[model samples]
Target: MGAPELMRVSVFKRYLDELAPLDESDPHQLPPSLLQDLRRFKEHGRHTEPLEVLAASMRHLRNVAMHLQDGERVLPLTLFPRQCLAHCPLSLHELLQLPLDNLQVLHVEPAVLRPPGDPQRGLVKALHLYHPLPLLSWEFAMRGSREQLLPEIAGYAAYRASAVLDLRPLPIPTPLRNCVRRLQRETTSLRQLSEWPGLDRAVASRLLNALYLQAGLIVSRSHPAADTDGWF
Candidate 1:
C-alpha cells in the first residue's frame, strides 16, 4: 500500500510562543458535555477517501480546541486511542505505527475506529473519549515517552494516521518552526518529504500524522508537488 506524500511539520517561529494554541490540561478536566461531540462523532461518519474520512472526525477536534474556554469551545484544535487490550493485544499506538497497508480503519459505532473484531460489550472496549484522560495516561504509560516531537504535537500524533500535511496551531512552548515552515511553503506528500535536509521517511510520516490530528494538514492530490505514496 502506497501512502500519499505527507507535508513537513508546519512550524513557524514567529507564532511559536505568541499564540497559545489550546489548554494543555487534561481532557477530562474540561466539561462532561464536551464528550457528547465525540460521542456523536464516533456514533456516525463513514467515508472512504482518507481526507474525507479524516475531516468528518477532525471537525469535532477543531471544535474541541477553539470552542472550549468560557463555554465557547477551544477549537484551538485536536483529537485519541486504546482499550482494545481485551481480545486484541494491539494498542491503538501500535496500530498507528503499522504501514498504511496493514492499518484497518472500520467505521463503526460505540467508538472503535478500525477493529478486526469488536470486543464484547462489557469488556474493555475501544478508546471511548467519553472519559479521555484515563486512557491518555494509560497509553502514555503503555507507549512510554517520546521526545521526537513537542508534548502537544506528540500527543496529537498518537491518534492520527493519514493527513495531507498542514501546521502547528499557536503559542506552543517549543514550536518546530523548521518543520512547520516547510509544509506551509509547499505542497508535498509523505514520499516527497524525503527531499527535506534532515527528515527521513519515518520522521516525516510521524510529523504528518501529528499534524493531521491537530487539524494542521491539508489534502491535495493534484498539486505538482503532490504524489501518492501508494500506502493509502
Candidate 2:
C-alpha cells in the first residue's frame, strides 16, 4: 500500500515497551523487586538510616527510565532549531567532543547560523539548525566533510527569510534527498531521524520502515529487498 499508514507514536511506544526489559537491567523493563524498592524509597523518610542507599538506587533506576523514555518520545520531524536545542541541550564545542557514535542528533537554533571558519571534523550523523537572523547575513558552509550542514543551514535560512519556503518534502534537491537516504540507512529510530531538516511525510514513512526492518521491529513476509534505492 501507499507508505503503510504513517506509524503512530503509540505504535512505536508499544514496540519499545515490548523490546525493553522490566528490571534494573533494561530501562524499558522493570522487575517487581526493583519496582517495589523504588516505591519504598520514594515513600520512606529522608532521615532513615537506609534512606541514602535507597535513594541512590532509585536515582540510578530513574536515570535508566529517563534514557529509555527519551528514546521513546518522538519529536515532530519538522522541529525548529530552537526547539531541538531546548529539548537536548549541548554546546557546539561539547557536541564536537562527543564520539561520532555517541552523537545522536545535533539541533541548531536558527539552523542558518553557520559556525565560524570552514566546517571541520567531528560532525554528527544528523544535524538540525535554524536559519535567518534579521541582522546577520545568512551563509552556508558549502564545502566540508559535513556536507549535510549546507542544506540544514539553507533550509533554516529559507524558512526564516520568508514563510513561503515549503518545509514539506515535495521534489527536494538531490543533496537533501541523498542526506535523507543516508539518515534512513544509518539511524535506528524516529527520534534519531527527526534531527535532520526537510523530513516530510514521505521521508518519515521511509525512515519508519527502515528502523522497523533494521531493528527487527517487524517481521518480513518474504525475502527483504536488498536494495531500497527509490523509497525516498
Candidate 3:
C-alpha cells in the first residue's frame, strides 16, 4: 500500500507548540513577542522563500527527533538560528557579528582553530563573552590546543603490554616513528620481566629500575605514580 499522507502543517505546528510552554514556565523558550513576529510573517505572507524555510525547519525537527529518540535531553539552540538564516542572504561574517543575544546557537569545530585568525575566532570569543549557556557537547572537540593533538607514549605503552605495538603500519613522521619504536622496545622489555613465573623480586626490581630510567618520555621519575596512575 502507498504511504499515508503526511500532515506537514500539523507536524510543524506541533513542534512549535511543544516549544511554547517555556515562555510561561521555563524562560528559555522564544518570547511571546517573537511568536507574534512569526505570526506577522504568516499573515502578510512575507516569506519570499517559504519552501526553503520549511525545508530547513523540517531538517531541524528531524535532528531534534533523532536526539530525543537517543534519550538525549539537551535541545540544540542552533535550530532557531539555522531557521532564521535559511532564507536570509547573510554571509558567515554577517551572521557571526549578529548580536549574541539574538543568536540561538553557536557551533564550533576544530577546523575553526586551524587558520588561527579566521573570523570565527572573534565569533567564538564573542559567544563565550555574551552567552552564558553551556556549550553544546559537540563543542568539546574544538577546545584543545594543537600541542594536545599528538599521540602519546602511554598509548604505545598499553599497546606494547598487549603485544600489539606494530611500528610498520603507522604513518607517522620519521623522527616520531623512530621515537615510538624505541619506546615500544622498552615496553616489550618491561613486559618480558612481567612474564616470569612468580616474578623474582630482585629481577623485577632491576627491571622496574631499568624501566624507571628508560621511561623518561612516558613517566616522570619525580612523579612516577602520576604517570602510572593515568592522571594525564
Candidate 4:
C-alpha cells in the first residue's frame, strides 16, 4: 500500500535499462525468456499489488534469469502467513544480501550437520556458490506480505533431525490452543510434536512457521531431551 521495499523504482528502472538492447539500431533485442522475466518484474512492482504476489514475481524473475544463464535451481523460500516485521532490526534489503548457508548453519542442529562428503554438503556448497539470490528475494517478499507467506526461513528437512521447539507466549489460534497447551507442559521436537493427536507433520510444520513469524517460538539447538523439565 505504501511503497515497494525490495522492488524499488530506481532499481527496477536500472534493470529495465540493462535488459534493453545496447544498440537499438541492431535488429537483435532481449531474449524472449529474459523479456518474460522483465514483464513479471513490472507486473509485481505495481503499488496496488499484494506483497506476497510481488515477492513471488521477484523470485520468478530471478529464477528465470539464473536458469537461463546457468540452469541452476533457485529454490522457493517459505515465510509465515501471519508474520509482522514493522519494527524488525534487519530491513528486507539487508536480509536479502545475507548468505543463506550462514542462516542454515545457525539454524541446523550440530548432530545433523552433513559430513564433508555427503550430498547435503554438496547442496550447501552449491547454495553458497550461487548466492541464494532467489531465496533472499523470497525473504524480501515475505517481509512485504507479513502474513501471506509462511514464517520459517529454512526448509522442513533442515529442522527435521535435531530441532527442539519451545513454546512462548503469543497469540494462538483457537484450533491450536489445546495442542499448544500440551506442548507447554512438555518440550517437543518437530517429529514428536507432529505425532500428537490431531497434528500431522504438515500441520505441525505450519503452526511452527506461524509461531516463528510472530517471534513467539524458541528453537533450541540442544538435544530435545536435554532440559525436559518445563517450558523456558
Candidate 5:
C-alpha cells in the first residue's frame, strides 16, 4: 500500500464542483476580451506579453498618481498570471522573467479606495516604477509614457543600428563582459554596440530588447539615431 491513497484528480474535481452551487453556473474563467496587450499579439492571436502589458500599465498608473487627493496614496497593483494569484505583489522583477509565450497576464486595480470599506476588496485575488537601483539592479520595470520595439525580449530580432540605447543608469547584463565598462559610460546606438563589442547582430538585438522596458534606455524615435534601415 502506498502510504494510504489520496483522492484522485477526478474525485478532487467532483469535490470542487460540489463546493460551488450548480444553479450559479458561473464558469469562473477570465474573459479573453479583458486581455490587454500589444496590438501585434492581439492581431496574431498570440499570448500576451507580461512586460509589455506591465510597462504599459505603469504609464496608466502615473495618471492615477496625478489624481491623488491630499493625504491619498497610490496603492501597488499586483501583476501575475491569471492562474497564479498570490497573496501580495509589488515589483515585477520576477513577473518580467515569466515564460509568456502561452500565458495570460492579469492584474488587480484597487477598488476599495473609492468605496472606503468595500468587503469585496479582500475577496478579489488579483491585484512601480523606477529608482537609483544601485541597491536593486536589473529592475527597469519603469513607470513612464514611452514606446519600444521588439515584440519579445528573450529573442527579439528587430535590431537597428540607428536606435540609440542608453545604459548609463542601468546594470550591465553579465553575458557581455565589458558592457559595464563601455555602455555605462555613455549611450550607444545598436550599430556601434554590435561592431565594437564584436557581438553577433542577434545577440546584440536581444540585449537591446532586454533593456527596453527600463527607463534608462529610451530609444528616441525622433532622435537622429533612430533606426530606419529595415530590421537587422
Candidate 6:
C-alpha cells in the first residue's frame, strides 16, 4: 500500500502553517491581511523563519486565523517558497558568473528561514534569494560597507556556539578557507574566531559578510531549549 499523500505532505503543510503570519479556523488557510504582510516582508527582507521573533509573529497570526469566519479565492502562501541552510558560496559563484541583467531577475517568489520543529534535512529548501542575489552582490560589492551590510556580526560572540557551518568546496581565499576548516572542528563564536593565529579579525568579518550576503552562512536554528542567536 502507498503512503497517504498527507503523510508525504504533512511536513510541507506544517511548514506553510508555521510560515503563515495569522491563524485560520481551517488551519490551512491564511487571511488577506497576513498575505499582504508577507509581500511587505519579501520586499524588505524580513521573512526569515528561524528567529523567535518570526515564530512569535506566526503564533500571533495563528491566533488570528483561529477567529476567521469567511473565505476568499486568494492563492495559498505555498506558491511563494523559501529555502533554509543554503550552500551559498557555490551558488553565489555560479550566480556571479551570470550577466548583470539576468542577475536582476527575482528568482525566488520569496524565501524565508525554516521554523524550529522541522527535521535537519540537508540543504533541502530552494533558495528564495537567487533572483535578487546578483543585484545584492553588485550593491554589496560596490557601495556596501561591511558594517552597513551586516551589523549582527559585531554581537555574534554571544551565540557562536549555536552557529553551524556547512561549507561547499570552492576556491576561496586562503585565510577564509582556513577559518571554515577550523569551524568544522567545533562550533565557534565570532569572538573566538577573532583570535585565530595569523588571521586578522577584519578578514574573518569580511568572510562572514561575504558568505552571509550570498546566503552561504547558516545561523543557529531557533529552539526553546537552545538560543537561536537572533537571526541576523
Regions of candidate 4 where Cα sits further than 4 Å from its true position = 1-173, 226-232
Off by over 4 Å in 3: 1-163, 187-232
lDDT of 4 at 63: 19
lDDT of 3 by residue, 1-232 (tens): 3322333433444665665333333444334443343344346553312212222233333211111110112112222222221111233333234332222111110111111233556533222222211121111111211111111222223222122444342233565444345544544433333344544423333223222222222332343222221211
Candidate 4, 1-232: lDDT as tens digits: 3322233334444655666445534434334443443344357552222232323323333212111000121222322111211111234444455443222100100022221244666433222223232333334333332322132232222222212433333334555767766655556666667678887755665555444433345556464443222110
**For model 4, how many clashes?**
8
lDDT of 1 by residue, 186-221 (tens): 666566665566667655655564454444556564
Residue 120 CA error for candidate 4 (Å)? 47
Give the Cα-based TM-score of candidate 1 against the true structure: 0.32
TM-score of each model, paired residue for residue: 0.32, 0.17, 0.19, 0.30, 0.40, 0.31
- RMSD (CA, angstroms), candidate 4: 16.7
Q: lDDT score, residue 119, model 5?
A: 72
Writing each residue's lDDT as its tens digit, candidate 5 over 1-232 gives: 1222223444544545665333323334222223233444557664434445554433333111111111122223233222211222323453344332323232223222211123756544333222122212133222221123344332212223222544554545555636534555545556556676556554555455545434334454454544443321
How does residue 196 of candidate 3 score in lDDT? Answer: 47
Residue lDDT tens for model 6, 49-147: 211112222323332111100121111121111322222222444434433221211112222333223474552344532333223332333223332
**Rank order by TM-score, top first?**
5, 1, 6, 4, 3, 2
Q: Tens-digit lDDT track for model 2 on 59-175? A: 333211111112333222121222212111333333233232221221111122222231742421234322121100001011111212111111111111122322242334576
Tell me the lDDT of model 5 at 54.
50
lDDT of each: 0.36, 0.28, 0.28, 0.36, 0.36, 0.36
Q: Model 1 shows how many backbone clashes? A: 38
Off by over 4 Å in 1: 1-175
Candidate 5 overall Cα lDDT vs. reference? 0.36
| Higher-TM-score candidate of 4 and 6 | 6
